[model samples]
Target: MANRSAQDIRRLNRFEVLRRFHASSGPRTRQDLASETALSFATVSNLTSELIGEGVLVEAGHAQSGGGRPRALLTLNAERGTLIGVDVGETSVRTELFDLALGKMAVDERPVTPEDVTPDQIADLIEAGAGAVLAAAESPRSRVLGAGISLPGLVERERGVSTYSPYWAWRDVPMRDRLAERLELPVHLDNPLKASALAEMWFGAGRDVDNLVVVMLRSGVGAGLALDGTLYRGATNSAGEWGHSCLVFEGRRCRCGNLGCVEAYVGTAGIAETLRALAPDDPLLAQADGAAASLLTGLAARAAESDPIALAVIRRTAAYLGAALGNLVNLLNPETLVLGDQVAAHLGERLLAETRAALAGHTLAQPLRAVTLRLSSLPHDAVSRGAAALAFEGFLNDREVFGPVSRTRGVKARAEGRG
Candidate 1:
C-alpha cells in the first residue's frame, strides 16, 4: 500500500509538470516548472530528466540571462503521440484530433438526426467520425495515446455508464466500454459540464481564477463548477446538473418531465418555446423540430436586427437565465461566471448585458460585486477541446502503456544538463 501511494504521488507530480508545459506558450525552465507546479527543485529535475529520456519533453536551447550560465528550457515534443476528443450532442457528433501538446490537428463533424438515439447508433457515429478525423490528420491509429468523450446528460465516470440522457431517455448505458472496445484505446467519459469546466481551467477564462463557474447553454442548460482550482464533482459526480433545478413552481414543462426547471426557460428549446408563445407564426419556429441549431441561429440573427418579437424572446430568456445565474452567484460566490456554448456565443454581448442587469436585481450586493460575468473565449468547439484535455490527463496517469515516441526511439541520449 505504501509503495502504491508513493507511485500515485509520483504520477500526479508528473501530470502537473506535463500540464504546466501544455498550458504554457513557450518553453519552461526547470525552476519555472518547480515554481509553477510547487514541486521541489530536485523532484522537478528528476521528472524532467525521465520525461526527456522518454522523448516526451525535449530541451529547446537556453533562456537568456544577464549574468552566469543560462537555464535550459524544456518543451513538449509534439511527435510524442496523439489524442482525440469527441463531443456527442443531441444534434451532432464532433471529433477533434490533437497532437501531444494539445494543438488541434483535424476536426470532423456529423449531424445527429432525432432518429439516431440508441447507444449503438451514437457510438457508431463517434467511431466513424474519429476515424475520419485521424485520416484527415494523416495520423495512424497506433500513434494515438487515447480518447476523451463528452456526452450530454448525466454520466457515471468510474463505471463509464451514462446514467441518463434527457433527449434519448437512455438509462445506464455503458458508453466508455462501448467506445473503448470499438476504438481500441484508453477512453475517458464525462459530461459536458465537467468537460467545459476543464477546458476553462486549462485554456480559457478560468486559467488564472481559482473559483469559477461555467454555464453552458445549448439544447439543454448546465453549470460546471471549479472550486479552489479543482472540479467539485460531488459525491455522485452529478453536482453540475443545475439546469434541472426548479426555477418556477408549476410553470413550463421541461423535456425531463419536470415542471418549471431552469432548462425549460433557458435552453435552446425553452427559448424557442418562448418565441412560439409570443409569436407562433415566426418563421424560425418552423425549424425547431430537428434543426435546433439553425433555429437558435435564426433567433439570434432576428434579435440582432431588433425585431420586436425576437427581442422580446431574448429579453424574456435573459431574465430567466439571469435569475438562475444569480442563485449560482449567491450560493457559490465564484470569482468568474462564464457563459459558453453555441447559444451564448450566438447571443453574444447583447444577451450578456441584459443577463447582467437582471442578475444584479437577484444577487446580494457583496457577492454580486465580486463576480465577473463574461462570454467564453474558447471557440465553438470548446467542448471537444475539453474532451481532448481529458484524454491528455488520462495519458499522464498511465503513460507507460503508450510507451515512448516512435520518432525518438533509436536516438542517442544527450547530456542530462541540456535536458
Candidate 2:
C-alpha cells in the first residue's frame, strides 16, 4: 500500500466511487457510497466533489434514504456520452443508441434474410442505421463513445471476429473490424445470447441474481449462462451452446448436421420440422406452404385458440425444452431461467407451465424447487440493447483511453444537427 503514489490512490478511488454511482438504480449520496464501497466518508466526499467539478457527477435531486437530513443525491452526467449497439439476427438488423446511464435515446431496425447476409451488405445496414439513430436521437458522433454488435453465432470477441453463423451461413468473418471501418467509431462485438445475458444481468431480470441462465428460443435455441456474477463463456467461448447437445439419439436431423439435438426439437425451425412429422397434412403447413416464419406464427395462433394439432406440437416441443432445462437445473442450479425470443412471444405461459412440469420430472426435487423460470422482460430488442451496454461498459472502465478522442471531436453533435 505504501508503494502507491498519491495520484494513483486517488485515481483508483475516483474509479471506485464513479463505478458505484453508475451501478445504482437511482442517485446516491456520498454516505451511501462510503458505506457501499468501504471507503471512508471523507474520501468519498472528496472524490464526489472532484467528480462534480469534472462534470461527470451531477446533483440530480434529494432523498432521505438514510433517514437523517435530506442528503443531496448524485448521478452520472447522462448527456456526457453515448453508446450504440447493433443486433444482426436471422431476420433483421437492430440498432440502438443509449445515453451513459443506459437509457434508450433512439432505435432503428430493418428486415434482412440469410440470402442477404454478406459482410459488406450487413455493415452498410449497420452504418446507415447508426447514422439514422444518432440523427433521430439528435446525438452527435463526437458524443458517441463507441458501438457494439451482437451476432447469433460464436464470436472470437478479442479478435472481433464472428467465427460462424449457421442461420446466416456466415463463416469466419471479421465483422467488428469491418463495421468499425464503416462507422469510423470504436467497436466491440460478441454473441447475441451472451449480450442478452449481459443486459439481463446489468439492468434487467437477472439483476442481483448472480447464478442465472437466459434461454433464447428463436429459429434455434441458445442459452446464455451467468455463473457467479459473470458470463460463463467457456474454452473457445462456446459454453452455452447447449442447443447442440443430443436429446434423442438418431431421431431428427438438425441443420448443425446432428440428429435429435435439443434445438432440433424446441427451436422454431425444429418445431416446424416436428410438426411436419406428426401432421403432414395439417392446414398450417399447407396455408403457409411450409415457410418457417408462417409455420411458427400459424402454429402459435392455432395453439392459442386450442387447436388440437397445434397444441400437440407445442406440448411435444415443451417436453424437449423442459428436458433440456432439467439438465441445466441439475448442472448449473441457476437462481433463475428466462425464456425469450419467439418462444415467449408465441407459446407464452403454456411453455412455462409445460417446461416446469417436464423439468420437475427430470431434475432432482431439491434443485428444481429452488429455481425460478421467468419470461424475458426485455422487448424484442434485448440483444441490441445488451450490445450497446457492452460498449458503455468498456468506455466506463477506461474513460481516459478514449476521452481524448471524444474531446478532440468537440461534442459538435450537441450544437450542430446531423450534417
Candidate 3:
C-alpha cells in the first residue's frame, strides 16, 4: 500500500471522529470522543470544531459535571446534507434518499429486466428513481452530497466501470460517469457484494463484528467481505465474486457462462431450477408469472404450510447454500456470516436452520465452531441503504470527491426550508 499523505491522514482522522459521533446514541464531549477514538484531546477538539463550523455537527446541550462548568455536547446535524443510494439489480433499480444521519427519507423502485439493460438504460432508471425520491422528500439537488450505486457482477470500482455483469452481459460499462453526467452529482459505483458488506458494517448484523461475510442471495449471488474492520477489495477490486466459485464440475451452467458455480445452485434462478428438478410438474414452475421473487415467495409460503415438495426443495437448497457458506467459513474464518437480500429474506429461519445442518457436514469443526451464521436483520432494502453508506463514507473520507455541495456549510439555515 502507498503511504498516506498528511491530508489523507487528516481526512481519516476527521472521518473517525464523525463515525464515532454517528454511532453514539446521544451526544459526546471532545474528551469522550478522545477516549473512544484514542485520539489526543487536542486532535478531537480540533476535528469537532471543524465539523461544527461546517454544520456537519451541532452542539447538543451540555454534559453533566461534578464541578465547574459542564462540558458542551456534540451530535451529528442530520440537516447538514442528503445522500442517495441506488441498488441496480437485474430485476429492478431501487433508489433511496437519506439525511446525513442515514435516516431514510424516501424510496423508489423501477422494474428492469437483465436482457433489456444497457448502460444508458440503467443510468436512466437510476436517475429517475433518485429524482422521484428527492421530489417525494421535497429536497433540492444541491443538497445531495453524493450518490452511491451498487451494480451486480464484477465492478471495477476505481474506474467506475461495470467490468462484467453476468446477468446483463455487460463489459467495461462506464456507469459512474454516465450517472454523474445525468444527475450532475458525484457518483460512486460498486457491486452489491461490497455495498451489502458496507451496510452490514454500518447498520446491520456486522455492526459489532470486524470479520464479516455478507452473502447476497438474489438473482445474482455474491459475498461482501469485511476483514479486520474494513471492506477487503482484492488486488483487482473484484475480491468477493464468491458466487462464481466452482461448486460442481460440469454441472449446471451459470449466468456467467461458467459450469457449476455456487450461484448456479444457490441464487434465485438456482433455487427455481432446484424446484423444477424435484417436481417437474410443480405448479409454481409452470406459472405464467415469470418473476423469480414471486416464485420464491410462493415456494416459501408452501414450505410454511408443510408442503412435502416445497420442504424438500428447501432442504436441497440448504444443502447447496450450506456447502457454499461452509467453504467461506473455513477459508475466511469470519466472525459472522450473514444471509441477505430478497431470496434469503423469503426463506428466513427455515433456510437458516437447514443450511446450518448441511454446513456442519462441509465445514471443519474448528472453523464451524468459531462462526455464527444468521439471517440479516436489515430490511429488504439493504443494498440501497448500503449504497448510501458507501457515499457517506466517500464524502467523509475525501470531501473533494463530493464536489461543491459538501464544501458549503450553513446546513442549519438550509434546514429551515431555505436555500
Encode model 3's per-residue lDDT on 1-419: one tens digit a residue: 13544444455556556766555578899888777666777777777887787788899999999999889999889999999999988778899999998889999999997566888888889989999999999999999989999998888877898898887788998888888999999898888898888778767776667689999998888899987666788898888889999988899999788899999998888888998898988888865145887788888899989999999989999999998888899999998999998878999999999999999999998989989999999898888988897787767645554222211011111121211
- Going through the candidates in order, what is the number of backbone clashes in each? 0, 1, 0
Question: Tens digits of per-residue lDDT for model 2 on 1-419?
Answer: 34444444555455556546544578898878877656777777887887687566899888766576788889988887889989887777899998877788999998786567788888888999999999998888989988988888789877888888877667899988898888989898888778888777665676656688999898767898887655778877777988988899897888888898888888877787778888887767664432566777787788788998888888888889888888989999899999988767778888788778888888998888889988887787888888887786556444563231111001111221211
Candidate 1 Cα errors over 4 Å, as ranges? 1-13, 37-40, 400-419
Considering TM-score, which of the candidate structures 2 and 3 is the better prediction for this target?
Answer: 3
Top candidate (lDDT): 1
Q: Which stretches of candidate 2 lie over 4 Å from their true place?
A: 1-25, 31-56, 65-70, 286-294, 401-419
| Decoy 1 TM-score against native | 0.91
Q: For each candidate, C-alpha RMSD in Å?
A: 5.9, 7.8, 6.2
Relative to the unseen true structure, what is the C-alpha lDDT of residue 131 in candidate 3, on a scale of 0 to 100?
94
* Candidate 3: segments with Cα more than 4 A from true spot: 1-10, 35-43, 287-289, 400-419
